[model samples]
Target: MSSIIPGTQNALTAWQPFNGARLSVTSKTSGVSSSLPNSLQVQIPKVVSGPIGFENTGYWGIKVQSGWTYQGSFYAKSTSFSESVVVSLKSTRGTVFASKAVMGISTSWTKFTFEFQPSASADTDENVFNVAVDGKAAAGQTIFFSMFSLFPPTFRGRENGMRIDLAEALAATQPSIWRFGISVATRWKWNETIGRLEDRPGRPNTDGLGLLEYLNWVEDLGAEPILGVWDGISTANYSDLSTWTVVPEADLQPYVDDVLNELEFIVGDAKTTEGGKLRASLGRTEPYALKYIEIGNEDQFQPESYAAYRWNAFVTAIGAKYPDFEFIATTLPSTALTPAYQRIDFHMYNSPSWFTANAFMFDDYPRNGTKWFIGEYAVTSTNDTNTLGDIPSGRLPYPTLQGSAAEAAFMTGMERNSDVVFASAYAPSFQHIRNYQWTPDIMTYDASRVVKSTSYYVQQLFSTNRGTHVLDTTPVSSNDTAPLFWVASYNNETDVVFLKVSNTGSQDLVANIFLGFTATDFATATAISTPALSPISGLFNVSNTLEEPELIIPVATSFALPFSDRFNYTFPATSVTVIALQSTTALEV
Candidate 1:
């Protein structure tokens, strides 16, 4: 009795796992022999540099069922080099269900796979497979692998294997729209006595991925979800009891009252209609209406009178019981005594040309009216792993938990200054490439699977295309070129016109937009990508396993209704386009 498949084309035809597979192996190792298909040849490695050789441990199966979808591919070649390469799908008791990894330099044979859907604990048939090669493989480089088969679980534009309209049009972009939240106040904890996987649990203490599965994976990519909460600082150190610098402020108010009673059981577990229980209820006279709340993250290096007397007794007890909710204040080294602290969250690991050459560190911060939140930014020099395996507490050269592209153009100059910024999150969002400490994170999903980041499509094109009225134009070029544009003019009375464009320079940005008059046609034009001009070759390999997590997915392509009232449109450079124009005329260019 599993029904409920209404339209939108049956939710765009479910069933995914590399829709339409490909991967054949045995590229040539000259008379190679070990067994089954000559044990898949071997000898072309270098994925992060040195020590990684499955060389010939062959049998890389994939035929999945119980609702079908199995996509695995292979091709390898080398000349110059960089290092790192992995592929998996084991479960004949060998564990590992899905995996991915392929970093730096390639002389040819490029194509890797990891897409799944045999869930319910998979294994309907062909499954158990293995392939390893963790960096450095010269001595006559030559390797190849392949396997592909994406079929009906439902089938439409591609599910599980990805392309759900290009992951809702590249999530829609702004660093995947803020998703940094390390609950139980990350001083880092999760040993639950040999239970690994970040000590396995929920809300803060490191399961690392699960804040409602990161808001159902950023609301399944339509965008807008800047949420983070964890005022549970406990820095350890009962006299070097594994040193983290000891932050026992009288045991942090029962772990910030069990994180404010699990944020009041997730905003009073909203759900009601006769049977009751869904979760997210406000209006109970507003005790937890919260649009976003954060207050004890890096708690000023702890122990300062127990982190400023438990953040001034938790803003005098939840700001005298929810003052409409906005609260954010942690990671402050100097915001000048937190000015009665209402809003001020900063943590930039520097670089985007030092945030566009220190763009006034957020406009020469003065804070007369408060309001400023960056909440742990990243470019990575190493703060801890976010993605990229071998993390049994090793591996750190540049890991503010995985971030680069100049920290996604410093999150597009922090969304071109979202009007003095009020919310921004992107730290320790995810890390499970061998149990992280921080590497590269903007999105990482396991315990079910999920991944998105190029700064997560530039924060989902900036919170799903915002602009409810605020346009002053003026951008022919501020010394920028190649599709590097940024414009906003959202008027949602229903006439509809959400033109958010961000190219971030590289190429392909041929505009024409003159939304002054007569511009109807563009009912939708979503394009959240990964394989357009190679941004580290379409992501999704911070070593992802678990029955093939679509490596790094988010592809959405739709174009039909009217978009040529003399408005060419090309934009792709660094990608991020959300144009949903539906005008009937109403001024404001």
Candidate 2:
């Protein structure tokens, strides 16, 4: 049983990004230092002396902050083959962060990457970057390098908000039913040289994240694992994408059966040589959960074949055995809704401009018949450094904040229509520190540490505080001129009412909130705010380097508490505020 405290106004305050932080890029060599070829690229000084190495002596680095896998890639080619090359990340204090050695082949360009988890003793910190070619280089053989990256392995409770306690709390609230998921064609990369860390063959991939890794990641995020099946043919290059479907069902069966069998073991029917299961049940100590199976990722390119080759087979075999779970297809026959499938899926990266022009884009789609999920999305202007591409509009004055606000607004829409928009998440949630393709992401990490963007805080605000009841907010005319103003209240079972007020205009406005409630046990109020008109510039290239990140955070302040039903509040122009009201109805008095 829950009820909202009607019309309550609490004087709000402010909160900012971490104040003492800064991020800067400094060159270690005595020679010239320049910017790299791409937008996110930063240049390191060319070292050409004693050891004849291309080692990153002084640059940013990150740690394997909890996870079993790390992934990153960079291109390097030399005039001579057979030169010794080691791509590594080390701490300023000389501790080895993480590294992968690449054996120089021919004069042709080669991309080297490593996937690893922290050693038992590994600890995370800032100042991490790509450490490349740590040995002697041939006198006349120069090497070029770009697109260096790293992805740590997934572990239980390691995701941003999927802590065990948090998951349990969500379950306790029981707002929605749990669903299992998986991917078929998406994120199912093959570890061709699956044996060694360095020797494993690598290339551009269609799979967003490896299939096993994606399931593990989703489970860690507290979402039921929805497996996406692939046409599974291991490749040393993206050019050799699997043709199991393009050819014939006879050709696809062997690959399909093998993967399905392997998956069974990962999901608990089969056992691992490591002697332990992959995941635990909800709150289990082991921390992996799998409940859904998806046929393929974005199979629209080969819909007919995909349906016959993978989807049909999946429905026949796995579906027969696990009829209880839901099946999600990327697209239906023609209509927006279909009862044949449990849910419909869409992938959106149509530039931030697309969202700005059509914020209610999803509303145009019919929801009376089926459920939908924006499986993968991002507001990035560019995709993987491709410039001839669509440049997204809605660019923020600040690059760091641009993607954040847009994403939050988009998410609010999803939440408002959860009946149809079942799930929404940003695609390519990560980027290799220096190998970024997109303009902005929620969180970024190198081999050493993680950094939060303006978007991260926004997501944290809504996610950390789940609202149980939605209040009815109505608009009214005011004599006092100000920017657009709107306020809504949410009452969580936690005995707190969260009042969120937004002033999108340039003029400051005085706001008065009137509270009507059943009880009166008043408590303190707090706020998280983002102020407008900062003296700092909002350029996309602007970063709070190790020397100065304060350019990004919100400032914090407090106000005296009042146990009054009617109160006055000031709305700062172009700011976001979260005001919590004390519960007057749940008092002992």
lDDT of each: 0.46, 0.45
- RMSD (CA, angstroms), candidate 2: 15.1
> What clash count goes with each model?
78, 66
Query: Model 2: per-residue lDDT, tens digit, 1-589?
Result: 0011111121000100111111122222111112222111122234333332333322233443434455566555544435655555555454665566667545544666556554434453543443443223443344444334444442353422232332342333222223323323233334331222223222233222333444454443455555555553221222334543354776777756655554544544324422124222222234235555556666665566655555666666666655665677765544322235667677666443354334445545675667777776665552333311333443322224444444444555565456677766555444445556554555554444345555445555555555555454433312132233333345546656665544434345677667655324343332223335455422332333323434455444445446466566775544445566657554321
120-158 per-residue lDDT for model 1 (tens digits): 455433344445553434433544432222322321332
TM-score for each of the candidates = 0.27, 0.56
Model 2, TM vs. native: 0.56
Best candidate, TM-score: 2
RMSD of 1: 23.7
